[model samples]
Target: MKSAFIILLAALPFAAAAQTTQAELLRRGELTGTRPSARSQARQTAPRPANTASDPVQQHLLQTDVNLAQASADQLPSLYERFIATTRDERRQWTYPQWDAAGQVLARLNQRYEQVRTTLPLEERLRVRSFQGEFHTLRGARQVKDKLD
Candidate 1:
């Protein structure tokens, strides 16, 4: 049981990366570069959010300046589906701000999942767990991609 659990946990990030790698986001952007626009650049340069959050999850969200907390308990499955759809098939023509905005929406979706985790149906919760990991993985990958190039 322990080994199986360990293997599943180890593969989660890989699975997430497989769905949407950092390189993929950069390659799909129209500007041919990962540079932020003037407005996003200003937001990035602005003073960081306060670090007073006791929860690690809240702290991470603050650090990214992308709050994607979802408010609707009944919307998790559909929202995740929409996210997956947008990212997979429709975002190829997007620019930097669109990418950034998508990232923010992704963040909110994850937060909404967190908000309703306990209240969700078993199948919905399970489905969201998969999406939540993918979003975090994508966010981490994108943040690294931005920093590197």
Candidate 2:
């Protein structure tokens, strides 16, 4: 039992990482929705003066920004779907309680991921993924070791 507990503690990170990746992707997708499109840019720049404040080029750029904002907003649901899929597919050697705890962690991660998604830069998101992966690996190993004993 002692060993099992230890193992679970260690594997927590892997579970979290898998979960976070899904969440991040979802967030990214949402953010991209509000961004501008390719064709719009070409039209905007074709006839505009380089320095004009109200130039078509500038307006297009602004539109692009708005598109990105819309995209970002759209990303969250996608993330949730992917996250759910990944978790569903991952192999679980965990006991019922361990699994339940893992589920709870996933829930917490989803909540936090959404919160962080609002303002997180790409680099920070990457870090979150790495850390979450490490956590899962450690927790998984601990759980296995305990079970074997």
Candidate 3:
């Protein structure tokens, strides 16, 4: 009975540290006491705020940005659609500076979207994500095209 008790006590540490390796265990210190916090484990850093209206380059201020800023939660999808259509149709003619301007405008619009995202329907949220993905793809393609040229 004493031998079994000793075996279990020894096994307890191994069980608790099944995921960790020898090097990690040595570096992180003894896991016998308190575990390290999630905050100390390097969570994703927050994004820095963009300078929209105050941008030094004086970005292309689309009328959609004004409308989107004033829009209610339910109106966002339609406003996004308007912005997407305008950008999609116009992007073929854009230079690097124009693309940069469009990106700044999109960033400003995204800030507005974040404010009311939770209030939107699941379908609208998915649609917005889809729009964002498409815009990123379009922007990447433009960069590639520029590099080729």
- How well is each residue in 26-95 modelled by candidate 1, as lDDT tens digits? 3432111134456545554676543233434333323333233434577557667656655655444555
Candidate 3, 1-149: lDDT as tens digits? 99999967766544543344534432332121123355423321445444334443232334333444455788767766765777788889888787667665665566566667888888998887677657666776666555445
Which candidate model has the greater lDDT, 1 or 2? Answer: 1
**Model 3 lDDT, full chain set:** 0.58
Q: Which predicted model would earn the best lDDT?
A: 3
Model 3 weakest lDDT span, ten residues long: 25-34
Per-model CA lDDT versus the true structure? 0.52, 0.43, 0.58
**Candidate 1 at residue 31, lDDT?**
18
Error at 84, model 1, angstroms: 1.2
Global CA lDDT of candidate 2, please?
0.43
Model 3 bad stretches (over 4 Å): 1-67
Each prediction's RMSD over C-alphas, in Å, is: 15.1, 16.4, 18.2
The digit string of per-residue lDDT tens for model 2 on 84-140 reads 444444434446564445444343343335444657667656554554454455455
Candidate with the larger TM-score of 1 and 2: 1
- What lDDT does candidate 3 reach at residue 42? 38
List the candidate numbers ranked by lDDT, top first: 3, 1, 2
Model 1 weakest lDDT span, ten residues long: 26-35
Q: Candidate 2: lDDT of 124?
A: 54
